[model samples]
Target: MKTTRKILLSAGSVLVLLLTFYLVWANTGLGSETKQSLKIDATASYGDSSNKGNVVGIQAFVEPVDYASEANFRRKIRFYMEEAKKKNWLIPNKSIVVFPEYFGTWLVALQEKERIYSTPEIEEGMQTMVLRNAGRFLATFLKCPQDVQDKLKYSVFAMKAEVIARVYQDTFASLAKEYKVTIVGGSVLLPDPVVENGLLKTRGGLLYNTSVVFETDGTINPQLIKKAFPTADELGFICPVKPEAIPVFNTGAGKMGVLICADAWFSEAYQTLKSKSADFVITPSYSNGYGYWQQPWSGYSGSKTPEKAKADVGKISLGEAWVKYAMATRAKEEAGIKKGINVFLQGKLWNLGADGSTIVLSDSAHATPFVGKSALINLWL
Candidate 1:
C-alpha cells in the first residue's frame, strides 16, 4: 500500500509540472502566422501634380493591439505602405513618409497574452502581463530606480525595453529600405535609448519619448530625436528633456524637422528648428479620447501656456486650438516653416480611443482638416 501511494504521488507531481509548463508555453508563445488585407480608408493630397518633392503623411488608423506576434502589428503598417504605393505617393529616394506619434510605443504589449487586448483598463492588462512574466519583470524591477513614483510603469518599460527597441528598429528600417523612402519612424517611449553604429541600444533609466529617422537604405541616423515636452498623461512615467534645439534630418527631398505632438505648441521649438534652416517640419501627433477634439480647450496639457497662446484658450474648441496654437498656424508664421504636415494617429486601442485629423501646410497656406477614418495626406514640395 505504501509503495502504491508513492507511485501515485510521483505521477501527480509530474502531471502538475507538465501543466505548468503548458500554461506558460500557451501564454508566451507567438501564435500561428496571421495576415490582414487592409486598404486605404481615406486619401487626401495637396500641391501640384509634380511629385519631385513629396512629403507623405500616413494618418494610420490602428486597432486594439494584438502583438501576439510582431508581424501582426507590422501588417497594418505594411498595408499603409502598399496603399501609398498604389497612390503613387511613394517615390524612390525622392520622398519622405511620416507616421503618427506613439505608433511604436504600443509595442510593449508584444507577445503578451490575448486577454491583454480585451481588458477594460490598460493598467489591468499590464498587471496581468507582469504577473504572468513575474520572473522577468522582477529582474527588471529590481534594477529600476526605487525613487521613482510609478514603479509599475518604470519596471514594465525596463523589462520590455530591449524587445521594444529591437522590434521598433527592425520594423521601421525594413519598411524604409523596402519602400525606398526616408521614414520618420514614429516615436516610442524608451529608457535612455541610444543608437550605436546604426543599432538602437537602450540603457535603462528614465523613459523618454524618442523618434528615429531611417534613411532610404534602412540605416538609422545616429542622432536621437527626443521629445522635450510630455503631456499630463505622460508626466508620471515619461521624462521630459529641457528645451533644446530640435533635430533636423537631411533627406533627399529636403532638410526636415520633426516635432512630436505637444512639442509643436511651443514657439521655442519652432524657433530652434528655424535656426537650423529646416525646409519643412513634420508633426507626428496623437489625440486620445473619441470626440475629444470637439470638447472645450483645456489649455496646454504639458506645461503652462506660453504668453502668446494665453488668449486662444476657452475661445476655441480643442480641434481649433490645435490648429491655431500648434504647427499649422504657428510653424509658418513663427519660424518661417512654410511647408509641414500634422498627422494624427486615428482608430481605437482598448478603452483608449483616438482623434485628430490630418492638417497639411504648403506654401504658407494650410488646408481644412481632413477628418477621415484613416487617411493619407501628401504635399508636393
Candidate 2:
C-alpha cells in the first residue's frame, strides 16, 4: 500500500511539472533579434584549365525571426556577406558562393514567431502555428481554388506556401545580382517548382525540394534541380522530382551540376550528372542533431534515424559515411569528376538539428573538412 502510494505521487508530480513547463512555454514571447554572419574559408584550391575558379562554402545560421521575408533574408545574408567581402572572399568577378540545403526553409518561423520559438519542437510549433494562422491562411486560400488532389495537397502546403515562394525567389535573385557573383542559392520547398522563361514559378500544391543556381544577373534556367530522393523524414512534406537527370548548369564559372541533400547519396545521380559534361558537383545538404556528425551512420535517413539500419548495410559513423559514400565512393568513382563541393546548413530550430560539417572533395578521398561554429572552404576552379 505504501509502495502504491509512492508511485502515484511520483506520477502526479511528473504530470504537474509537464503542465507547468507547457504553460510557461505557451505564454512566452518571441526571442530577441540576433545578429549573425557566415564564416568563410580563406582559400579553397586554385582553378586549373579544366575546372572553374574558386568555390567558396559558407557556414551560417539562420536566426528565428518575425519577418524572414525576401527583404529580411537579404539583409541578414548581407550581414555575413560583408564579412566575406572584408576577408576578400568575394574574389573579384571570378568567385562563386555556395550555401547548404534548407537554408531557405526557416522562413516559416517568421509566420508565427512567439509560438514557433517558444516551443522546442519544430513539428509541434508548426502544427500550432498553422492553427494560430488559420484565419489568415483561409483568407489566403480562398484566392487559389484547386481540384480535389490539389486541395489535399494545398492543405499540407497552405500554411506558408505564398510566403516561402516569394521569399525563396526574391531573396536569392536579388543577392546574385547585387553581389555580382554566382550562387548555388541553397534549396527551398515549393509546390510544383518550374522555370518559366528564366524565372522560378510554383504550380499545384504538391511540394518538391528544389535548389536553384543564379548567375550574376540572376538569369533563370540551367537552374532548379529538384531533389530526386528525399529522406523518410521529408516524405511528410516533400515530393521527389521526376527529372531522371539533373540539368547541367553553365555559369561564367563553367558547367556545374547539383544534387540536393539525399540525392547526393546515390551513385546513379552522379553517373547521370557526369554525362551532361559537369566538371564538378555541388551538393547542398542538411543533417540535423548535435554530434550527429560524430555519431554512427546507422543507415539511410527517412527511410530516417537514430533509427538503426538493417543487417546488410552494417553500421558506421555519420561523418565517416558522408566522407566515404557521399563524397569519395559515389561522387568520385561513379561520376569520374575531379572535384566536388558540399555546403551544409547549420542552425537550431525547435526540434531540428543542423549537423552537417562543410567539406571539399578532391579526385581522391583526401577531402578537407571545415568543422567550426563558423567555417569556410575555398577551392580555385
Candidate 3:
C-alpha cells in the first residue's frame, strides 16, 4: 500500500509539470501575436531647414559655407533616425517619407549643367556648380562606377535624378529592414524632371513641381506621375493646387501626403487631402523668413496709453487663425483628431491636431545645425 501511494504521487507531479509547460508555451505565442496586431504608429521628419536664421529659398542649394560639411549632414540624419527609434513610434510594415524642401529643380539643373554645359558655364553658374559637386560626391559614395561618374559630369541632371531616386530607394529599403516600415515619399523637389511640356520649360523642358512616391518592395509607383500634375502647364514650373491632386491622398492603408512649404500655406492642399481620405499630411517646409501674412483691420480712433502703444507696436497677430482654419478644414471634414497633420519646419516638429491646435513635439534650436539633436514624436490615439 505504501509503495502504491508513492507511485501515485510521482505520477501526479509529472502531470502538473507538463500542464505548466503547455500553458507557458501557449501564452508566449499569444503574446507575440497580440503585439503584432496592436502595432499602429506613424512619424514625419522635416529634412534640412533653418530656424530663426536668415531667409533662404526652398531650392536645394549647397549647404551654407558654415554648415556644408558631409559629416554635419550625416549627423543630422542620424539624430533624426535615433529619435524615431526611441519613441516606440516607428511603424513597421508601414511607410516613412522625407520631404526635403527645394529638392526638385535645383538638383536637376545642377546635374544638367555639370554634365552637359561648358566649363565656363559651370564656373559662372553658382547654384549649378554647388549641386553638381554634391551629386558627384554622393554618386561616388554610393559606389557608382568611374565610367558612370565620367558620364554624369556631362549629363549631371539626368545622372543626379537617377541617383536621387536610387538613394531614396536604398534608404527606404534600409529603414524597412531595420524598423520594418515602408518609406513612402521619395525626396520631393520642384518640377518633375521626367516629363516634358513646352510652356513649363525652365531649362529642362515642361516639368511639374512634383513628388515621387517610393515603395519598400523596390518598386516606384506611378512612374509617369513623377512628372504629372493635375493643373500644371507644360512649360510652367509652378504646380497650382488642383482638385485632382487630391486623389493622390487616398492611400487605402492609411494615406500619407508630403506637402512642400508653399503647398501647406494654401487651403486647397488641406482640402485635397480631405477629399482623398488621407489620414495624415506631412508638411515639410523651408521658409527662409517669417511666413506670417496678416490682413489689415479698420479701427475707430481711440486713446491709448504709451505703454500699451509700445507693447502693440510692431506686433503682428493672427488671432485664432490656425485654430479657426483647422476647425473649418480638418475637424468639420471629420478628419482624425486634429493631430493628423504633422508639420516639420527645418528641425522643429509641430503636431497640428484636427481642431487647428498645435503641440511642439521636438525642438532642436539649442543644438547648432548639426551638433544638437531632438526627439521624435509618438502619436497615440
Per-candidate count of clashing residue pairs (backbone under 3 Å): 0, 19, 29
* TM-score for predicted model 1 compared with the true structure: 0.90
What's model 2's TM-score?
0.78
Residues 1-381, model 2: lDDT tens digits: 999999999999999998777656544554334444344434345335333466777666654552433455777677656766665666544667888887776666553545455567767876765555566556645644443234433454545766676777777777777877888878877767777876577775567777888778766554578888878777665667643657887766777788887787776687778778777778888887788777656687764322223432456667777776675457777877777787777766566667867767764554355353555666666
Each model's C-alpha lDDT? 0.82, 0.67, 0.35
What order do you get sorting by TM-score, best first?
1, 2, 3
lDDT of prediction 1: 0.82
Q: Top model by TM-score, which number?
A: 1
Candidate 2, which ten residues in sequence have the lowest lDDT sum? 303-312
User: 1-381 in candidate 1: lDDT tens per residue?
Assistant: 999999999999999998899676656643333334365777878888674578889888876453556887778888888888988889999888999998888887787776776667877878877877788899877777655667778778778889999998998899999999999987898988999978999998888889889999999999888888889888777887765647888888888899989998887898888888888999899889888787888799968987776787887788888888889988888888888998998875777888888887885555446574688888888
lDDT accuracy of residue 201 in candidate 2? 73
Measured with C-alpha atoms, the lDDT of residue 364 in candidate 2 is 55
Candidate 1 error regions (>4 Å) = 1-37, 364-372
* Model 3, runs deviating above 4 Å: 1-78, 94-100, 103-160, 184-187, 190-204, 216-218, 223-237, 249-253, 265-267, 290-338, 347-375
Number of the candidate with higher TM-score, 1 or 3: 1
